[model samples]
Target: MNKSLIEKPAGCSSSILSRCRAAMLIGVSAILGSSSSDAAMNVGQNLDGITYYSSGSVFANSFKACGAWLTSPVAGGAWDTGFGDKGPSTDAAFVMRTDGYPTVVPFTAGGVSQYVHTLAPVYENGTHRLYFTGKGTVKYSGPGVAATTRVLTGGTVTFDVTVTGTNDLAAYNATGPSLRKGPSSWYIDILVSNSTDPVRDIRIMRPGYNTSGRDTFDSDFKTKLGFYHTFRVMDWLRTNNSPYTKFANTNGKDGTGIGKDFYSQGTGRGVSVDHICDLANETAKNIWICVPHAFTNAGMNDMAASFASKIGVGRKVHVEYSNEVWNGMFQQATWVAANVSGANTPQKYGTKAAEVFTAFKTKFDAAGKGSQLNRTLAGQAANSWILDNSLITAGSLTDSIAIAPYFGKVFTSLPSPLPTMDQLATDTYTIMPSVRSWLDSHKTLALSKGKVLLCYEGGQHYVGTGGSENNEALTDLLVDFNRDWRMKNLYRYTYMGDVNSRGVQLFTAFTLSSQWGKWGSWGSMEWLKQPIGPNSYEAGKEWGIRDWKTNNP
Candidate 1:
């Protein structure tokens, strides 16, 4: 699940009393927030249609980042676990920082004795199999990293070992001799350690890979995620809690000649806007961007100008300011509450959103792409009054009002003895009417405001909350429910039916894919090419979305 899914439950805050009351009245609960060959031909038509949700962030365990060159953020210290700029407190035995290089040459026994490491996505349990290609003298130990005499002298090293129980990367150990002299490209197919040991630099560091103007994104990533009409990059860009306050602080260059060598991952700022635009171009999809809340006016203008100049000629751009500013769980909400002067949080968000919209519009107009720009105002789905208040300030500048009308929140806090899969399915049928009512009111509101309604994020919100997620039995039940055919039917028939009938112009689901654990089963499919069964469990939410799209088209 994306970071957005880890937010506090709806109505948890006092500011949203109305939302809670509205949710109760409608029987809706908890807030959560597809295709290939045939998808390409319908690109133009799909722009006004549904698109896939935003891609997940670049993490060691990220399904999106797997099979790619980049891994998790580098850690540096004596024990091989330090992050950011924390200097080594004890003897500096080893160090692996950003720029994909270790300052230290050799790994000491003490340094590599016990250390944290990065693991490939979906390699947490069972037998781990992977290949490494690089130039290094290293040894590995631990359940996650197979114990082996590692040798990477321009040849691939293979690891085929079974790990019992949970494979924790933090318990890995490593020992290595001095790295080979001269520049060498270190690429690991797996066991990319996110540690402070010298081995980390060798495994995670490699230069001149993406600079050749070749495909930077993983082929699997493109094939699995590229079919969307528009790609929302809220998570991809790391727009929430953004560290960028100026254009110079960004990772990639802007304008026509956007730089090829962008530091896409291993930093909080995330993939640069230039690279995101490149992704949109490569996939032949429209782009949806979330402006960083911390960006200055000058910085925003620079980003907007770059987006205007670089986005593909025919593709559209959907612009929103930050993400979920109404939710206090995010920094953007606090930022608006403090920085932007308004009567309330909604008004402040609206004011900032209008500014952001105007900035992009100005640049798009100057670039003769104004018609392709769609400015969106995102509001809480359960609370129409939030939209009403926000639109009062930003309606004239907005093209659409976006909401995340997810279902299954009521299940998050269900009592002990969780409902059986069949019972859960039956209960799901009861919730759609309220959900449909919620959509109808929002659609009505959007129409009254002379704007189309858009679903920025929406899907089944069946995950537990308030520590209920930690209940292994409940987690099993929820995961099984998502896998059931009933879940797919709910999405294909009930959920999409409600969305389409309400006249939603565009609907993007919550996420693409991620591992289903205690965090929440937010992924439509756990991973790309995860076998959909002839059995009901095999065909999960992704199949449902595919069926809906096929039928709707």
Candidate 2:
């Protein structure tokens, strides 16, 4: 529910406020030494420490009980997001075949035929819920076609869209299109071109995490990644077929086992470590767990002792505390950014992040837990063979580093308009060297202790127009990215997981292709089929890709 509106009580004139302040000095929560119109207690002012702002006030009689005012903050608490695609009110685009010439006559809002330019169009989603309307049509090139005879009735067409951000023309396809969830957060995609031509080949994908301000299904997805649940999925895989290694959390706690709680009972809002152990004990295979954040020290120690006492400690379950703390790749940035004054305040977050991690580590060691007690830190600040003076002086902290060489293009060119998908990819490879230099400088720091450096997350983006026949480059790019970066301890951002298409490119493709079906296959047995790409029919010879891969590949 939205927070209640706050307003100053009526009869709160200057004299009355002074008296109220005097009487409530000790009764009030704040003990500040200020009392004026601009003071925090005044009307339309943020009361709590939270940063909320009030809209312009409507002058009302101060003599009345009170004047209600609205206070809406950018983000004050849990976000209540909307669901489902908003369908357009217009009819579907009409397919016309006249005089032996076939053409697509776009529907217009007004009942009239308008002329328009011709361009070859191919779409990803088969279920065209949205349609474009345009007046006039170019003459067909067929031999028997008559000039100036071709006409298209312009009107509305059914399109599913939720307008967000400045780019209103953009819409979310089940395929990859950067999108956000909530009241009206615009989609976040690297603009390829500001060209007048309508964009095609632009692929939208959902994000694993919405650090880029894109909406995401992470809260739901996190449930699947639970230490125990992921193990079940992995076990199902290995027992039935493939041989993949299991991943462990940073604390070195095995997928299955008990861990003591240093503080209160393990009641924090996180997937339970014991749950993973229970699954593993049930004979699950290929279980992996990577707890993104370090548990409080007391909790960590308790978990370690509990785990060791039950199953005995080993390397099967691994844990790394300080991994990629400084990189823009991980969600750690979100926690750091939250405490920061603004996105531009690098020093604010940078120093605070180190302090938080340091406290976390001290508690872990003091509690006495885990087989590998030493924390592994990654993404530390470095310059050549020495630590960066700025980070060192600024109090950057971590034991090891996890570097993710995520070098890609934000755009073909930024000063002017954007570029197309093809142009975006070309620009990525061209800008790769700057990324290499950054990595090399850090690698020089390896001159000292063999600090752990793991590639925690890595992948390349695919931007292209057209269908399977024309967009082969996308598949090839994915194959190459996997081949190059598939190293030990590496975890890809996605493994075909998403209920909605927002920031992730692959899942969006599946969504846009009508792969989920008319009702969205969300709760039905068919929902499992949503992950299959458009080529599922040809590749799986079955409706569901998961089933197809399970049975065939």
Candidate 3:
């Protein structure tokens, strides 16, 4: 826990140096709203003390709502917004826009029906200013929040806000037809104290008849909100999402997609994301870094140590190689099989993953974090081949074998006339047995070999057609059902210790923060803008607050 353990990597490449520059510019923009639109003029002036932020780059494309899906659309295609030569500009403004609308489930149906935008919260002009756009006049009710102007139709709206610890929010669009259709989105940021420090709470509140954006704010609303419970245990690196480059040009998605780009690792979006500043501002989080296969050692270490210093050495960290190595949809998957010498068979992908793991481990260990780390191994979860094959060396080469046992994939492939939420729940629970079997066999095998089992990514791999007008009602049902069932019990705890399976110990919810519409519906619960409620991902982290506090304290 000493400061000595907080190591900052030296000798970053020229590219990383540029990235640091981009990151620096973003920090400044976060405090002083970008001079792009009227939202900045009004909102920035009204809410003088609050800061605003989008998940990643606002220009990044939205993950495309309700269309070709799995059959015709590409695999892992939806995952990558834009990367490589086709990425975003590092000089892009800090914005929060998505490609398509990840339609919302009506609030009346127990789903959040809106999008949540984020601002980092800054104080100027005697008060911090916050701004966002809504469908109609909506009244926001929460802790220490007062809207300067909440009227008219879709344009920049401003609010004067203050926060202590975690805050709760709800919007009432009286002029709009109904809560579900009227309220568009609410932008919120949390502050632990009056100090000028930034708050990283960016959960979106969607319009809905049955929406409730509640969270298990375990951390004192006065202290480092939610840090003890959620932030401490989380792997923030987002492995595959990290984009290390040659010219600090995050070339990452900087925002064109619209409402889809939740986290930036793809086309560097808004303010050209450099998560280092993100970590420094919200220091409670532990990163889940996935070192891009092509990144330079200096660049990778720079990111690793920067994260270590912010998170501190006392915290446990996960060093994963690439994102999803087995999935052929991603570039990494294709590159691994085609390029890595003998990395031909699907089994060999794990071997490649191990290589990346080893490489990063050497860097972290050199940085004096040997005892505070876990070298995670990635593998295909649904398949039995990866259950106990080349992916592991019993007790060596890996600390945990990552698996993906999603419950909703079964429902996604069906054509139209989708089953109701009740049916979805029924069918999902029915599949639990087989899922438990698969997890049990693999989990048992891994534990026997002295390696821990983790869900590298797990969630409802299905995104309903709710984003479409025709399936809107059905979407509401699905969202409601997911919220009532899948969101909490199933994803975070339900199968935690099933009858037969040893149970997945630590699994990343397929993903963490995602834009509204399909990706926001299921699997990843890190954060949801629209259908986001108190029991959203925030509650998931809160589930272990008491235990975490007791153990760590």
Best by lDDT: 1
Model 3 agreement with the true structure over 1-553: per-residue lDDT tens digits: 0000000111111111011000000000111111222111000000000013222211111111111101111121232122112234321222212321112111111121221222221111122233333343333333234443344344444443443322222222244211121112222211111112122112232112012222211122214223221221122222333333422322223222111123322233222124323432444444444566545545555545544444465656666666555554455666667766552445565565555566556756777877767777765554556536555332366787765544442222334676654455344343344444555567667768788766554344333322342344544555455445333443223322221124445534423332223222422322222332345434342232222223323
The list of candidate 1 runs beyond 4 A from truth reads 1-8, 11-215, 250-260, 263-266, 411-414, 428-434, 532-539
Clashes of each: 5, 65, 84
Model 3, residue 54: C-alpha shift (Å): 4.1
> Per-residue lDDT for 171 in model 3?
28
Report clash pairs, candidate 1.
29-409, 30-409, 118-193, 118-194, 533-538
How do all models score by TM-score? 0.69, 0.32, 0.52
Candidate 1, residue 85: the lDDT equals 21
Which of candidates 2 and 3 reaches a greater TM-score? 3
Off by over 4 Å in 3: 1-285, 305-311, 343-348, 387-395, 409-418, 428-433, 459-462, 465-470, 485-493, 499-503, 510-516, 523-553
Where is the poorest 10-residue window by lDDT in model 2? 20-29
Residues 133-232, model 1: lDDT tens digits: 4454544443344456665555555555444444222221232211111111112322333233333322221122212122245445566555467667
Deviation in Å, model 2, residue 58 alpha carbon: 52
Ranking by TM-score: 1, 3, 2
Quote the positional error of residue 356 for candidate 2 in Å.
11
Query: Which regions in candidate 2 have their CA more than 4 angstroms from the true location?
Result: 1-268, 278-296, 306-315, 322-324, 327-374, 380-400, 411-421, 461-553
Per-residue lDDT for 1-553 in model 2, tens only?
0000011111121111111000000010011111222111100000000000101000010001111111111223212111100111112232212110113222221333321222111112212121223333323211121222223344422223222132111232335322211111111111111112221111111222112121112232232122111121211111111111122222222121212221101111222344344434433322222323333444444444443333323323333332233434334444545644533324443354354445444544454433333233334322222233213423335444433222222111122333433343233333233433444455545334444333232222222222221233343332232222221001111111111011111110111111111111111111111222223112121123233113221
Residue 235, candidate 3: alpha-carbon lDDT: 21
Query: Cα RMSD (Å) per model?
Result: 10.4, 27.1, 18.3
